[model samples]
Target: MSGRGRKIVWGLVLAFISFYAFLEHDVRGRFAARQSVEPAVIVPNKALAPVMAMGFHNLWADFSLLNAQVFFANPEYRGRIEKGMIFREMIELATTLDPSYKVAYFFGHFALSSYWNNWGVRQANEILKLGWKNNFDDYRFPQYIGFNYYLNSENKNEIVKWFRIALRYPEAPRRLIWTIDRMLRGADTTNHIHAESMCAMCEDAKEKEQKRYFCERCETYTALIALNDLRLAYLRDKGRPIGSLGDLTAAGYIDKIPVCPNGCNWLFTADGAITSSSLAESSTDVRGVP
Candidate 1:
């Protein structure tokens, strides 16, 4: 081609590229703005999610899991206990898309149940029950069911029932039998149980970080129990509620308020109850203690 013709073609090409870039940027900006304004919603129907995945179901499942994490991490979603957060639906879709996704089941149970004062415990239980159904040979699901029941529902019978089922599994964590024994022996509280169950869980932890977490949790629970006992004594002696951890020190209940190993301060509830700030609302160590 002639130089003039080639220059003209090059100019047109540049113009087209610039226009395409501008259009793409505008479209992306509008899409982002729309996403920011729209409420987070999930397709609740599990059966439809696979169809939506269009043969990339596992990738879709992974996307759902990541999306759930993002949704939970959003600052706007924090401290909001109301339903329709789509956490449950996202997890449900994930597990439906890939039934063998063990992490999804575990994360779904932990996140939902621990999120808002056991508000999602029932939902977590549903996920766990599905996990149990799909992964029957794995004992963790039944064990989780027992723990959730014990911590959230305070249903002794259900706790025992699920624990027994867990124990029956060959792959059950060794802590299951200990938990059953403790529960049967009337060691309903941490004081009576001696943190053995917690320690067992810590020992059973496979990852170094998980082991550290469980050990720290055990220490925190033990500290909470001791603090609770002191608070009870103060209540009995003074005939009033303990206002704060300092009150325990001021009243000569102890030399000083014990520090939580988790680095969170102990919380003194208005009802004269002592709890750990680090523990979740559905934690067995936090619940049913005075």
Candidate 2:
């Protein structure tokens, strides 16, 4: 209301308008954009936002990598591992934060499927969903989906569709990709049948062996099928209350239990070779079985 007060107010209003204009000016547009904020831009090499959001320790995954190295170096304790659920949870939490962490995706799949059994299926599916959400155009997600169907859900159609999508990727492994392409080009074919065909499609004996390995190695339902057959053998021969691999073998059904690669141990072969994914060897009772 007073002269001096009114002048001060007018001066402040002008300064405020100038600041707004400065912010909106073309010269400032680039700096205002997200790309200009280096930290905000999603860097492929770094832990992406989702991975950061999960509150998982990067050190844990790193430790897992180290443990894998130890495993490769001295694979003496293949049978003993505990805390499988925890390992899976960490992997799920990590990939949930960074879906593109391919190593985590793959190792997570292996840790869960091979060691923890189908306990990893839900985590694998979660990873697949995250991949789909973040990078749908990437065929890797669909390939994972197909893998899950083949392993967990046993949905042949869904498996075929996803395999087809994976085959479209430029970086896909040609032999496997072409095998999937051929299978998807057909209908009503089971995975076992598809796997046999894939083996036959191989031109070289070594390549055929590799294909056979893929078919038997966690990628197929071999583990689950073997476990089922072993269970049935127990039920049929010795009844459900049976105990020990020796018992199964004595019953003439021991061959039903599947075999892992050499150096893999039989920590618990009473019912089957139930490996502990997250448990250390010191924690398991590996004394009784021969």
Q: Which 10-residue window in model 2 sums to the lowest lDDT? A: 38-47
lDDT of 2 by residue, 152-269 (tens): 7555657755665565566666566545534442433233544343333332224444545444333233343454456566777655733444565667766554454333433543
Highest-lDDT candidate = 1
lDDT of 1 by residue, 115-156 (tens): 755666767788999988988788889888887876675555
Model 1 poorest ten-residue lDDT run = 281-290
Candidate 2 TM-score, true structure as reference:
0.36
lDDT of 1: 0.67
lDDT of 2: 0.49
* C-alpha lDDT of all candidate models, in order: 0.67, 0.49
TM-score of 1: 0.51
**For model 1, which pairs clash?**
none
